[model samples]
Target: MATDKIKLEEIILKAASVGPYGVTDEEIRNSLPENVAPNDRLELYNSLLQRGRLQLKKLHGKLFYQTVEEQIANKLQALTAEERLVYSQIEGAGNKGIWTRDLRNICRLQQTQLTKVLKNLELKKLVKPFKSVKLKNKKLYMLYDLEPSVDVTGGPWYYNQEFDAEFFDILYQQTLRFIRGSSSAVTVEQVASYITSLGISKEKLEHGDFESLLQTMIYDGVVEKLYQRSNNGSSVAVYRSCRHFSPFATLGDVPCGICPVYKSCSIHGVISPSNCVYLQRWEQSLDF
Candidate 1:
């Protein structure tokens, strides 16, 4: 029995060694000797666990088996003392990422020192900087290999740090054109399918992306969201372009809308709303 147990452990370990990502239970079962019974195979797996040589974890509904060494590396040990501290804070926040000011506050480091540390970490490929779609001006730091959270990524409407403004505009117009050119009110799925048929990259365009952009257009009065009764006596949500829809309704509607110096035009800056030439022009136009 002792010799059989040792043999089973070796077989399992050998199978695991061959799997770079870790082996599944079925793989181990298949790797066992043909003469080995199912009951004995189950016992071997338990024996390996009791022997402390094998580790098991369930991920995404599958059991992954690996040796202790095959587990994740100690990420902190590879960094400098300050980098480790900053990384810990960033990793703690996970996909949400850490804001520049909050990271500085947590690390209690000078601005220059923090900037230098972040740059060094980025160069080492250990950490990276990304801007949130919700707040484009604020830079958030996250692990180099991790995806930003939905909140940080700003749903499917954003690509990288910048919003897909051009894509949104194109898609909005295309959707409106489809609705106006068609005889019937369009369903959400039809709009999504039409966008997909345009051959945009699946990674950049998703169903949720269409929903978000359409909702925004609806709120802006470019499209109308309505529910119509179906043949089954259930109401289905549909969209139609508003009769008064203006493609450029959002542009130049506010003072900042047409401001070329919008970036530098802060509330308390030299290029502020109070001293803006555009504002003055609009005010004079109102007087006339």
Candidate 2:
């Protein structure tokens, strides 16, 4: 797989930059300096065809970008359709957390059958989580993206190893930029709602792509959880979307009983307040 017969690094870089959409070969070729001769391009292209190199291809009369998935698919053309489906789920997450139900919805599989496929994937050692927890009889799975397997030049390829924190950080930035700064609110649903209103039609969010992107944002420190206390104050409830780096940095380990700012503070109430002065700073901190 590491054969130097082809410029794998170059191909992978091109593919990684263009995934989610294909970049044509002509795009790559045209990116070359205006001074280059067309004959040189033709010679180089024919050499690749003659040598059976993987870095390039001619398709639909235009050169398009080939993502790491496409490269892998070409190399492992023998994999069964079921196997490819699992691989798609793994890549589709894009460093975000992936749930069995989300995967089922993405692949359009029945809920029961999705469970079996998830188990099969687990048994194969192809996917796993950094950690897992059960709440209210639901299983939440996280992805530990593998960076070691990444080529010297990185792309969205997953090798069997631990996920790199930096990759998650990038994904966080991407998702946060998508949300229009509304993630700072107290409710996950609120953040989600803000996004929905900005003309992100409900269908787009429901497409599983947006959800996966949101999951990655939450996993990375780019966005955070805004825990709401139940009226009884016995347990905390998670709102729909989540908290950004907004005010109340720590989410207050202290309940109102212990908060130093409890009595005189105009900040959060015994519970979190709707607005905070620190919010602007958090908003500015983002690359937006």
Candidate 3:
């Protein structure tokens, strides 16, 4: 009986080695010795399942046998139905994470119940909470093993859910310096390559990030964007220092002059002049 059990265990382990798709019952049976009694084979398979060494899963329309780590199986088995539901939702959200309110709405759980379940999951190290840079006050949840996406965390531009103004300022200065040092208008690709050569940023800066910085410089009146025809007859955007630009120029007193999102501001939009905090603050600071 002991020899038969060892042999069955080896066969089960071998079947599990096929990976996540798992093996069908027919495959497992074929791998087993023909001399083994049917009853003994069933008992051995049950023993492995009961011990959490193997798992039976139904994928598509077929049943398969897959191996699961004992600890993971035990942890999953120990979860309550509510905890499992919440965990699955968080897992489904992946690294981007799901907002707490969204999770509650999708799971159809009361705030208190959801909070309790989240606390339990956190205690078990199955999930963790993060703050979105765009919505700092709201909490987001994701699997503990997953890292938050750049969109959720605002990439390297944010720290602790707050915009790192100093970091932005440093990049701003460096980018402007590169543009001013150039003999003529430089293409966006050129500026990006220059920044990459500097090795100032630990995280890889995308081309769009550089473009955004250049846009902000344009807003600040320190840089000007121009379109030049390339050899292929395609128009390529280029940047150069604004020779006439000055910090104390005519538009210096107006907050709109340097607002990065100036183009997006509209009368009926979210960032309209009526609710423009910076403009209001500037107006209030002026001498009566």
Candidate 4:
């Protein structure tokens, strides 16, 4: 009986190790040893649940069995009803985070009351607030332990809720240098690997970030992307420094090229190019 119990525990642990999303009942059942009786397995499963070793979480309308740490469970249990409600909503938002106004509406709590609850959660180190890069003035709340999504934090291109143009320039220059220094065309993976090895960023950067940088370079006419057939006849994209790149401004070199509000700029409107501060600044910076 003791041996059977140990086997059941091992199987349960194995099934729960898949990921944070947890495993389904069907998965758990398939993992159980054939010799273990259905009633015996049920007893062990119930025993774990009663002891708070496993938590049943409903995600996307389906129930999953997730293993929760005892300390975390204890912390959650200690939360007041309101705090739990707020926390659950923030957790549902995931890494993207929930805005304070949105949270208020969703929780149906008054502004003053929501403020107090958020402060309490902050004090308890259960949740935190951060400014989103897209909306610098607005703050978003998320679970304390989660890293904000790239969409919220604007990846590594931003710092302190502001775009770090200097950092971006450094990456741009370094990427160009790598491409120019290489004898042959380089793949995005090769360029990303090279940039990562340089340890230029304090925050983690994804491969897509470097790929975007390369794309920008391509747009600037400084680098060109070429496709080459691989050993298995798959086309592989590779980048090389342009041999006869034009010195004239490419689309991205102009102020309007990368402006977020370019669509709103009209010939004789409030946001026309004549009154554009960005274009004015670019003009002033030009020596000629």
Candidate of highest lDDT:
4
- 1 against 3, candidate with superior TM-score: 3
Which window of ten consecutive residues has the lowest lDDT sum in model 4? 245-254
Error of 1 at 134 (Å): 4.9
lDDT of 1 by residue, 1-288 (tens): 899878887888888766645799888888888888889887877766655456676668888887533222333335578886787688667678889899999999999989988987888777888888777899899988788878888776577766777866777788878878868779889987887788654565666667787788787777888999999999998988787755445545567776677898788999998888777766676522
Residue pairs clashing in model 3 are none
Decreasing TM-score order of the candidates: 4, 3, 1, 2
The reply for model 3, stretches above 4 Å from the true place, is: 1-78, 110-112, 246-252, 255-288
**Residue-wise C-alpha lDDT for candidate 4, range 151-179, written one tens digit per residue:** 88888888888889999999999999999
Q: How much does each candidate deviate from the true structure in C-alpha RMSD?
A: 9.4, 19.5, 8.6, 4.9
TM-scores of all candidate predictions against the true structure: 0.54, 0.32, 0.58, 0.78
Model 2 Cα lDDT, one tens digit per residue, 121-230:
56555556432221223343433245222122122312123344565455445446655444333344444555567653323343243445555555544554445666
Between candidates 3 and 4, the one scoring higher on lDDT is 4
Model 4: residues >4 Å from true position, as ranges? Answer: 1-14, 32-53, 252-288
CA displacement after TM-score superposition, residue 181 of candidate 4 (Å): 2.6
Global lDDT of model 3? 0.84
lDDT, candidate 2, at 45: 50
Model 1: ten consecutive residues of lowest lDDT: 68-77
User: Candidate 2, residue 50: CA error in Å?
Assistant: 18
lDDT, candidate 3, 1-288, per-residue tens: 788688778887688769656798788888888887778777877888877677777778998888766676687778888987898788768789999999899999999999999999899888999899988898989888778988898877888998989988888898888889988999888988888888888888888788888888887789989999989999999999998866543366888989999999999999999999998897787653
TM-score of 3: 0.58
